[model samples]
Target: MVLLVPIIGGVVALGLLVWCCVCRRKRSSDDEPTRPPDTSSLDTAAKSLGFLETLLTDDRVLIRRRFDIRDIQFERPLSKGAFGEVWLCTDRQNTMLAVKKLLQHKNDAYKEIKDFIAEIQLTASLDHPHIIRFLGVAWTSMDNLCMALEYLPTGDLLAFLRQNADMLTWVKDKLPMALGVAHALEYLHNRPTPIIHRDVKAKNVLLTEQLQTKLIDFGISRDRTQETMTAGVGTPYWSAPEVLEGNRYTEKSDIYSFGVLLSEIDSAATPYKDVRSPETGEPLRVWQIVSMIVGGSLRPTFSDACPQRIARVAKACLDGDPNVRPSANEVIEMLLGRAVSDQNW
Candidate 1:
């Protein structure tokens, strides 16, 4: 009776184990059909880089400009931004260049790749002295996707203006800088298919060793025909009222930014920096300033030191009516006339 009882217990234990194993197998089989496929092999860095290379090859304009990653020699980082960094690099020929490299982990990899390609396409198609020169693009992996450009040691226009405020004469320095920017805008606006530089601020204007201005950063600039009625682009202080209101972007919007830039040049300060609230006597907040600007109740203030002719042109640019704002060519003419008169004086 004792041996029989032990045998019965062992048989029950084996039966329970078998049942559990069968249930587990059934559950696993049911889940297997719903499980995501293994995409790890397909989504690798090599595949992404390969895809980018294929896209670039398809672009006739870009195919000729592709630089092998081995040819570029990294020197040091010049600047860092949200999604990428600019490095001061050199080519095989020892020619110095600025290379903007994409940081893939910061954003959706596909979107970043597409935007980088778009920038490359637009920059390579452009040929102008007042615009930043696109040297070429290079990449070994997705993380190393890079755009090479001509290096400007003098830094951006805003920093240059502030640094040389005491030494820079209006005719020799400020006027020429403004004119160069105006010329760049004129070139962009008059393109066979016009381009609206949605973001035009002092920081985007880079200075050469000779302090000549070159318009840089076309990531936001769009062909006017392709532009929708999108708003909320550009630096607030430099943006036009129409742009703030989500109205269609036009060349006049750039003129408004140029007007704000004039204020910047004159005071060597950001637009509306001196503005204070009538009630609190404190500097107005960005929202308040934006509201006032959109309402056409506020325009950027000029310094007392600002020349009257420049102020006049800036005021015309900042006019509440978009129709009333001067075209880029008209602005150029007005400035040129003033420049000639100053030279005569």
Candidate 2:
């Protein structure tokens, strides 16, 4: 009986220590301090590296618009962000495309511009049904970056949920959608030089009319062969624990972010709710997500319209441990909403 009291005290002490560490991490943005991390040197250290071939393939791979881009007009603005806008464009070839027009940064260095070009090149190199296809790219004047891609008319998953879908339809919809997304992510993650879609969230995942999920927006994606990101490189919501902790890059981290994304999908909303966070008394950094779920601070209960089985999968995906979080392939199988062949992931 006396030994129990000391053990209880030790547990309380451990909890306090954890609180202090979390508080310290929040109070000081110390984690983001590393910068200008000699990417050249870092690249040398990578266990495996993606061929810069996509970027190096040169001017021949780039197809300049034959018809005046002005002549082949876009039907509507598909989306807008800090980097210019996206439009639904139709070429004289009658190919429907989603064009991303990037705003030129006058002060941007040559290397920075090349990096953006690299992203476009990477997209163009892949031709997968689950991946958003890169049709072509053009530098309209040096400053602006533009990419022509296969147009997806059905929009993203969040938009579908907002339409007031019923439970049965929601399950039917999410499962296949998740499977497609899993295929895309697994293909990226399993490469010799694995590509971490550093940003994996509802919005970046696009759905086609056929319901196949296509991964878009690799602006912040990283080659996992490298040790770590150069500090400030990910969208806050789907950022992983190690990313927040400023640890080295690992494929497991993407799995962590995927968990958040999966949870958000079931909840029918973006992962981070912009509400005041109880932990730091400020907006939550991404890793606070684990605490939020464990502490019951954030609830991802699916809407009444969502299926019960789908909701369970969402919760499982959000499991705090990245090791336990299922792979994108596993996610695909689950989305089929069939019996999981093995409970051990």
TM-score winner: 1
Name every residue pair that clashes in candidate 2. Answer: 175-335
TM-score of each: 0.82, 0.69
Candidate 1 clashing pairs?
Answer: none
Q: lDDT tens digits, residues 274-326, model 1?
A: 66756666875666666667666678767666677787888888887888888
Give the 10-residue window scoring lowest on summed lDDT in candidate 2. Answer: 1-10
Kindly give the number of clashing pairs for every candidate: 0, 1
Name the best candidate (by lDDT). 1
Per-residue error (Å), model 1, residue 199:
1.3
lDDT of 2 by residue, 1-345 (tens): 000011222222332334446445543342233213334564642311223223334445554421235534678898986655789988887778898776554332333455566677677666678889877765434344577888888888777655644452544666677667778888998777788877777788888877778888887677765443433355544555445444444666676666666655666667556544444457544444433433333434455655666656565565555677677667666666665564753
Q: Give the per-residue Cα lDDT of candidate 1 at 127.
A: 89
After superposition, the stretches of candidate 1 with alpha carbons farther than 4 Å from their true spots are 1-52, 227-229, 338-345
lDDT of 1: 0.75
